[model samples]
Target chain A: MTAEFWNGTMAAAAAAKQARVQVNAAYPITPQTHTVEYLSRFVNDGELDARLCKVESEHSALSACAGAAAVGARAFTASCSQGLALMSEVMYFTSGMRFPVVMAVANRTLSVPVNIWADHQDTLVNRDAGWIQIYTQTVQEIYDLILLAFRIAEHEDVCLPALVAYDGFILSHASEPVHPLDQAAVDAFLPPPGSADRPLLDPARPLQFGEVLFPDWYPDFELKKHRALADSLGTIRKAFEEFEAASGRRYAPVDAFATDGAEMVIVGLGSMMKTARHTAEKLREDGVRVGTAALRVFRPFPAEDLLEAVGGCRTVLVLDRDIGYGTGGMVYPDVTRILYHEDHRPDVLNFIVGTGGKDITPATIERCVELARGGYRGRVEFWPDARGAEEGVPYTEEPAAP
Target chain B: MPNTHPESASASAGRKLHEIRLAGRGGQGVVTAGDLLGKAAVREGFWAQSIPTFGPERRGALSSATLRMGPEEILLKCSTAAPGVLLVLDPTIWTQFNVTAGLVEEAVLVFNTTEAPEEVEARLRGGALPYRLGVERCRICTVDATGIALAVLGRAITNTAMMGAFCGATGLLGLEPVEAVLAERFGKRASPNIEAARAARDAIRWRA
Candidate 1:
């Protein structure tokens, strides 16, 4: 297969095309609009044999996808921050129903003043929801991960929906190289939806989805779902290994770079990981041993491996895009608890970087290292960013071009 | 200390990574210019990446796009604070913000004005805001890009014209790649933009 230049959104749509997604029921939003538009163009041009439901809202978009998937169709949908929030009600429901609906989430910052930019806040809001969440850094990762998403989500042992997220404009808009997968290879790697494994809403064998249950039965169901989620971690690893064999792109639950024999490890997720990884290499020349760990699978929450990646290091600096509001960065607590058992745990530093479309430069990374060397004072640091003084969405007299 | 440029350390001839920052308002096709330039770079057998400053994407609002191209893989990813080359689609964008805020000491500045480079620099010097950009070290090139865009595209979208000036100033990409990329980007509507690009590329000249 030939390598092509594509932004994250374009790569995702292209991957979805090769994966033979039968239904793309979506509401277009900034950062995510290109994806559905691509699918629409593909369908209109007769290149792709698929159905594109032009739904009005993200809520309806997901609902329509859920409906299509219930009837045993390969379904997909995508959205950004507020759109994710709007569709979150259905997000939980789709997972609870155990529909293998693969969704691509372009991570965006939440809105009090309507900032449509990159952040993990949107993707992590419903982390506890039964869906398997996978985050990607580059355009290639977005393409490969979405292809692997369907296989992981449809595993008989783990028939849960999946959400694949990448930074909104950083990756979604930023163009990079991605190797296109041949449809034959993808088709062979991923079976035909595996709809027969579970009871489908067929005309002959009709079953109700999202059924009401008694409190006593509901607890058992929730417990079973938790067990399935824990079990899906194994399936996720297997899927990644299989994907590697099939596609030659090795994906791990956590992408570790130069972690072995490192003194400091910078941990992050999504596009920021690329920054930390590259910056770590540069800092290594100055005799500062810095490693990087990017969490690829957030929902399965690769705790054991994450600890292993940071265990040899003397200090751990976390760059989280999601702010936990009064609690500090959201990833801090999730990661800090991993180091709790040690007699003398390495100093864990938390800094909020690249929030609300702010650029994460090498200087901010260097500053993080400096702060880490000084030892964390139990405070969350927000990097200096371009937060436009005047709030509200910038409005202009001229309209946006198509 | 201000480490925000999209480029890493300047490329060692064989490993050269050229960086360009396009500055203008939202409506001026600034983002598209960066994207097309990157595409052209890729066509010329180099790795290229482009990222636009995305936000409340309203027309006439301040907008910038960063394009980085190199013989090898370009890893440095950040908004270009200082680029090797700077192209501003609007002559008066300096009035709103210092278009040369983090310009490299010896960077090349290409403007979309009909006036000569000296007149443009004088106007910049004589503006209400104090000039903080590099003085006497940088080279200033002038192109009547708005005029060319109006003549060719029937509008003042000077992005392609400025891109042509970038090629002429840097020589990183030639006339062929620029025209090819424009055709691919605009499809049937490319003729005018290509025409505008050729005129800018030919007429781009710096002050003595």
Candidate 2:
């Protein structure tokens, strides 16, 4: 089918619809509301035959999804920020129980200051929750990855929950072109419903999920979960390859661009990668050796691929939209640890940027490159050094129109 | 605030990117207008993205939307630093905000005003405007979009009319795509909006 204009939320909802999600349990939240709202519309119009549960809270939403998945039914849900935080308990429980539920997270900043803008802190906080996490850079990736999420999460080898996170408002509300897959294509890519050949809560076949575990076996269960997540990288790679074959759109754990013999590289995740890449291209046009790489898969933390993307460069400036407080940016340590053991490693600098929906424009990326090249030695420096002191606030007080 | 105008490398990058900023109050369909603009661009086979900068939800609060469209993929997800076009659905918005901030050279500034372009500029220069236009060079286009909207749609929602004036001013997009998208979106009630757009397009007054 020809491409239609779709926001990131619409793309995600369309993917869920195409995957034939058995049950959709979600609470309305900003940025994320449109995804579930679209799903509800699909249900109302009879376009998608699924149960759209109008849940009271994000906790109940994920609980309902867990319940549906426990019964051998495909389940889907979505939320962000406070909503994702509320679903934290079930986020762990769903993965621990191996429900293979799929979720969409419109990545937003956490509260306290009470902001409703894009950031990766929400997803990064739950990074170790035993769930597969994939970040998207575009509206198309939202559709492709959410579709691939189902295939990867439900794979026999990786029966864990998965979440696809995109920048809130950036991806959630922005409209772009998305070539949605046909029903036949989606059907061919994913296994048919109720074909989850795993332990199910079948009345005929008695089984127990999330049962109480004694200390004696709990550590082993934890180890198994860890091993399953690490091993899921293979499953993820395989899915990416198969998806490329089916849909002419190729994806990798780390999507790299112009890294060949580059001296400086900018690395980022989610929607900011495109801007970084664009700035890199512009820098290259002026004969500056620069490149960019997008970290697509976060949970598996594809260390090798990430290394390959920025290993050869003299400097790797990581633009992280979320901070880990005392530790620096969430992705900063991850990158440095990967490069620490290497004989030829680049100096990785982390710039805490675009937090609370600040604009991570091409100009911001350029400033980052300048800082990295200037030998500014800070492990994690807020790009402007002082917030609100870089350029004038990019907003105008649009008073009520008379 | 840092002078962080949305950076405009479009000209030097050798890309034909059209960045647009829309200014209006809440409930004026500013975001919807951006959507239609982007959709129309997509219809003509150009990549387009439109985003609304949503603040606290309240009717009549100041609201804004941004759009970027080009032959190639529009990668910059940040707000438009230097818009090539600025559409002000409310003439009074000039008195409150610098609606013309960070406009590109030879940019198109369209306004919905009953007064002539000279009057609008006089008011802007007479210290009534809260901020300077701060633009280097631009072509100003004036249209009574509110009047057209009221005459055609019986409302003061000037988004469609402003969009039409945009097309008329820049000629970047054909009226066909805009009309087609309006037809597809509004169904039977599309005619009034479409008529408003056409009338605004026909009635645009230009000042270089």
Best candidate according to DockQ: 2
Q: What shift in Å separates residue A107 of candidate 1 from its native position after superposition?
A: 1.2
In model 1, residue pairs whose N, Cα or C atoms come closer than 3 Å (at least 3 residues apart or on different chains), thus clashing, are none
- Model 1 RMSD in Å is 5.7
Every model's TM-score: 0.90, 0.94
lDDT by residue (tens digit), candidate 1, A218-327: 99999998888878989999998999999888989999999998899998888878877878888999888999999999887888889889986888888888887777
True-vs-predicted CA distance for residue A355, candidate 2, Å: 0.9
Which ten-residue region of model 2 chain B has the weakest summed lDDT? B1-10
In angstroms, give how far residue B205 of model 2 lies from its true place: 0.4
Model 2, A1-402: lDDT tens digits are 446999989999999999999999999988799999899999999999999888899999999999999998999999999999999999999999999999999999999799999999999999999999999999999999999999999999999999999999888999999988889999999999779788999889899888999999989998999999988999999999999989999999998999989998778789999988889889999998999889899888898888887777899888889888777788887888888999997878888888888877777777778777878774354554334533542222222211
User: Model 2 over residues B1-208: C-alpha lDDT tens digits?
Assistant: 1111133232332358788899888878899999998999898888899988877867677778889888788888877878888889886776787777677777777789988877777676676567766654566768899899989999999999888887776676768899999999999999999998888888987653
